[model samples]
Structures are given as C-alpha cells and as structure tokens.
Target chain A: MNETLNFSEHRMGKAIVLTLQGRFDAAIALPVKNRIRSLAEDGSRRIVVDLGKVSFVDSSGLGALVAALRYVSKDGGDVRLANMTVKIQQVFTLIRLDKVFKVYPDLESAVDSFEEY
Target chain B: MPGRQLEYSARFGPNLDNLILGADLVARFREETKVNIKTGDQIELAVGEALSNAINHAQAVGDDAIGLTMTVEDGMLTITVDDNGIGFLPDEVPQPNFKEHPSHGYGVFIIYEVMDSVSYDSQNGINTLTMKKRLEE
Candidate 1:
C-alpha cells in the first residue's frame, strides 16, 4: 500500500527506464508529465516506464503516460510500459490502452524492444 | 453475512493529496469485508476514478470537501462520491477514441466499465456520483 509517488531514471542503451514507485494518481500526474517532457527534450527517443512497484493508477495517471507518448511521437519517439501490476493491467485493458502502448513483462524485455526500431 | 451490512464514510478537502486517503479508505473497507481480490481491485479503481474527478473539478471555494461513502450489503458493494462543485453532464462526455489514442476523458468511461450500475445526480449544489458492483456468490 505505498501511496507516495516517486520516480528514478537511468539510461539503458538507447532507451531511458523511468521506474515509478507508489500510486500513480492525479496527485503526481503533472510532475510525471513534466519529467517525460524533459526526457524527450534531452534526445531520449525511447522510454520505458516500469510500473512494477506502482500499486495504483487512475485516469489522470494514465493520461500522463498517454501525453508522454503524444509528446514523444511528435519527435518520432515512443514510450513503452513495463512490469504492470495485475490491477494496473486491468485498468489498461478496461480502457483499451493496452492496444496503444507496447507493454512488457519486465525491464529486460522493455529495453530490448527499442532495439527493433 | 447475507443480511449484515458494513459501512464507512469520510469527508476530504478538495486537494490532490487527499487521493491517498481516499484509496486507503477503500482498502480498509475491502479488507474489513473480506472482499475477493479481483472484486476489490475493481472497487478500488472505480472509487479512485470517482474521487479523482470530484477533486480535480472542485472549485476553490472555502471549506470545500468531497464526501465518500462505501457500503457492503446483501452481496453488493456501493460507493457514492459527493462534492459541492459545479457538476457536468455525464452523458455528454464522449468516450475516448481508442484508435486515436486520446489521453483524457477516460475517467468516466472507466467508472462505467468497472461498476455494475452508475448514476450521477446534482441537487441543491451537491453533485453525487454513485457506483455499484455485485459480489460473487
């Protein structure tokens, strides 16, 4: 039941892995959107958001990720999601976002996806 | 527990920080009632969406607070979120175009998807969003 939202970033080859810890709700959506904007500005075209530790995600949280995707797509970049908890995946599926974003089971697979591009 | 009913209620200020408290309240209700994990997840998500909508749309009037009520009775769970902010037409909200990959406007849709029955009513300056789910036998 981690309710605090926090994130850390690191580079993996051509992709940046942003691991989010805690609930991804409206409380932190703006900061996350800004973070993604900064990453895109820094020439990181490929991003993988690891949600292994994310206990929850509301529409605002999902909106931030979609906003990130749109922002990067303008620069011919992409954002992928990885390690979604069962609950998180349920929401994605319910909203049909599972079709829009490439989702992976773990960090290794998510980073590896960038190699195909 | 066929005829027994458990209930919880709380009022939170119109602040994003209160989202955590809203979530904790749901979790507490789920645990106390021994709700199944799958159903609990659905309840949590639906309630979270409802609360987020209320909080985000809240007008910064003095002493504005969102009211949340949850109850489990007769194999059903119901959640009602009330706010004093100006309300909008729920039917007028267009569903997100999945093909276009829209970012916003999924909040109301998700609530409808997870809950068995959803209704919205605004009366006497109070807007209420009520959601319900049937429990497995």
Candidate 2:
C-alpha cells in the first residue's frame, strides 16, 4: 500500500544503474519515467534498472520501462532489467513484456551483459 | 458450492491511493478466503488495474467518488469499479500492441488476462466494470 517509489542510482563502469523500491504503479510511473529520461539526457545511455526491491508493477510501470527503453535506444543504448521478483515476472509474462526487455536474475549479471557488448 | 460469504464496498476520491486501497481489499479477501497465492496475486493486480483506470479517467463531477465493491460467493470472487467519468465503449478501446511495446492500453488487457470474466456497463453517468475469477480448491 506504500505509494512512495524510492529510486537510487549507481554507476558501474559506463552503465547507469537505477535501483527502484516500492510500488511502481500509476502514481509513480511518470516520475520514474522522467528520471530515466533525465539519465538518458545526461549521456548515460546504457542503463540497468534494478527491481529487486520493487514489490509491485502495473501497466503504467511497464509503460515506464518501455518509455525508458525507447528513450535510451534512440541514443544507441538500451535499458536492461534485473532482479525481478517472481510476482513481477508473472505480470511481465502475462503481458508478454518479458519478450520486450532483457531481464536478468541479478544486478551483477545485468551489468555484465552490458559490459560484454 | 456454498461457503461463508463476504462483501465489502467503499467510496473514495479519485486518486492513486484508492488504487492501493483496492489492492489491500483484494489481499484481505484472499486471506479470508484462503485462496492460492497465484490467484490472490491475479485478483490484486486486476483490481488494482481497474481502480487505476477509474482514477485516470475520473472527472470532477461535484464530489462523485469512485465506488468499489468486492464480493466473494459460491467459489467465485467478483470486483466492481464504478466511476463518474464519461464512459467509453469498452469494445472501442483498442487492445495494446504487445509487440510494439505500448504502455497505456495494457490496463484493460491485464484485467482480462487475470479475471475469468469481465463486463462493462455505463448508465446515468456511472461507468461500472465488473470482473470475476473462479477460486480453485
């Protein structure tokens, strides 16, 4: 029931890592989307979204991810998801969004995927 | 097919907080009914989506609050979300292009995906969306 979306950022080599905790619902999606946009504008094109602590996500949250992907991809970069809970994974699979984004089991692996490219 | 039944309803201002309230309502229902975790999650997400839609489209209609009803009976759970917004034809709302990575239209689709049945009715300035899911023993 907590509406607060705490977004923390870290830098790993060339990638901007964002860790999100709290409900990624309609109330918070736009703000999160704006943060991603700002990151992309700051030349942090390669982004890793860490959702290990995020407890819930709806269509708006998924939309935020898609919007982030579009923004970063325009700069020849991408947004990768990591540490998604099984509940989050279920929602993604139901919407078939699992096919849209590269999801990893942990942040280290997600960061590694970007390093390999 | 009879068991202990429960019904609850609430009316609240159009806002995202009510969406979270809707989720809590589902969780409480799940706890009382002892439904499976997967079914509980599906119900929560579907109800949350419905409430989100209500908040997104609610118009200021002189204190007309969003009305939510949760009813569990006969091995089925039903949730209803009613709003005062100008109702559109549910059929006219296009399905989200999943391949295109569109974001907005997934709300209704998600409700459909999680619920066993969905229906819409708009009359006298109230738009009601009803969704049902069958409980597994």
Candidate 3:
C-alpha cells in the first residue's frame, strides 16, 4: 500500500480550507499535524479540514485534529471538520470527538459557519 | 469453525513501513476471501489499529518482530497481533478526553469499535491482541 498523505489548501474568506487525502493514521499524522500547526502559527485561525478524500483515520489522526482544534481555538478562533465518511465519523463518535468539533456535511456549510460569527 | 476455513498469516519487522506492507497483504487476503468493501474496510481498520499499537507502544529490547495471523471461517474473520514488549493493563486505559484535545491513546478504542470481539494477553515480555469481526454475507 502506498501510504503517502498530501493536503491541498485554499482560502474561503478568512478560513483556511485544507483537504486531506489518503490514510490519516500514525504513519502520516505528524506531517498533517505540522501543516495545521504552521497554519495556526501563520495567524490563520479559522480553519476547515475537509476529509472527503480521506478513507481512514486512526487515533493518531484524531489526536492530530484535536491538536489542530486546540491551536486555532487559542485566540477565539475554531477548527471545523467537513465531509467525513460514515466509518470515519463513527470513529469520531466512538471517541466522543464528534461533540468536540463542529462538523458539517459539506465544505460550503463549514465555511459559512465561520461567517456567522 | 462454522463454515469453510481459510487462513493466511505472516510476520514482519515491528515498524511503520512493515505495518504498511502488512496492510497490503491484508488487502490481498480480503480480496481472496471475497469480502465486501465495507466489511473489508472494517477489518483493515481494526487490524491496522492493532498493528499500530504493536509498532508504537510495544517496544522490544532488541529487534523483535511483530507477528500477525489472520483466519477466516464460518463468516467470521479473526486477526491477532503479537509484540515482544512491555504490556499494560487494558482496563486501565483511560477514555480520552477529546474536549481536552489529548494527542494520544485512541488506537485500542478504535479497534474495539470496528471489531466484534477483542481481547489481549501478556506474558514473558510479549503482548498479544486478538480481534474478530463477522464478515458480510
């Protein structure tokens, strides 16, 4: 299995939208986490992580997202999740992370949510 | 033990690269068994979690290999991951406080969610985790 993780980013108003592709597991979680950390350090606080292309996520991935959430929330900003597969969503629910992050069915809605504040 | 049985197993180095290779082997196993995508994905996730724990948490003194065994029988698939490392009490694992945004400790829980049954054993510097799931008809 080719286990490479790559992400694409774009700006939706003030929110930095990142679309992550490939497995979100221990082997690749650190790089993804570092990217999010860099974004936060660059003053991009409102972030939306799109998981539509992500096929799987383990604890490490979950932890990375949680870390991203914490980083962005430090200054009254937030990190939101979008387009999680049912299986991936189940993991979030199992770990009770579903309650911790704002989840939307699509990226547009997620970006719209930030505009509401 | 209820239906026709097929077994495939292998051992590999206890590292992330080997874990990825093992996952490929598992994908082939699923294809050979005609497992549906959803159920196969579950198996992949469960076994992946088990192997991740073995690779990340189970540390050996020297170069100990992680062992994997998979058996499909009677509409059920079973996988075992063994590591020669220090073991911990499964029951003592704390539920992660996602609200607190903790960065570790969710591997085993994901296994429990994806597998039908999961159990662990440890003795003589070896920790073994076994997980089972019912395959789709």
The models' CA-based lDDT, in order, is 0.88, 0.83, 0.81
Q: Please give the distance, in angstroms, between residue B12's alpha carbon in candidate 2 and its true position after superposition.
A: 1.2
Give per-residue CA lDDT, model 2, range A1-117, as digits (tens). Answer: 344678989998768899999888888898899999999998888899999998788888888899889888997989999999998999888889888899999988989888876
> Against the true structure, what is model 1's DockQ?
0.73
For model 3, how big is the iRMS in angstroms? 2.0
By TM-score, the best candidate is 1
Residue A59 CA error for candidate 2 (Å)? 0.6
Model 3 misplaced stretches (Cα beyond 4 Å): B61-64, B98-101
Off by over 4 Å in 2: A1-3, B60-64
lDDT of 2 by residue, B12-110 (tens): 788775567766666677777888888888887887788888888757244447888988787777789888887767777788886787767888888
**Candidate 3 per-residue C-alpha lDDT over A2-42 given as tens digits, one digit per residue, 9 for 90 to 100:** 45567889999768999998778878877888898899889
Model 2 pairs whose backbones collide: none
Please give the lDDT score for candidate 3. Answer: 0.81
True contacts kept of 3: 0.62
Q: Candidate 1: where is the Cα deviation over 4 Å?
A: none
Q: Worst ten-residue run, lDDT, model 3 chain A? A: A1-10
Q: Considering only N, C-alpha and C atoms within 3 Å, which residue pairs clash in candidate 1?
A: none
Point out the higher-scoring one by DockQ: 2 or 3. Answer: 2
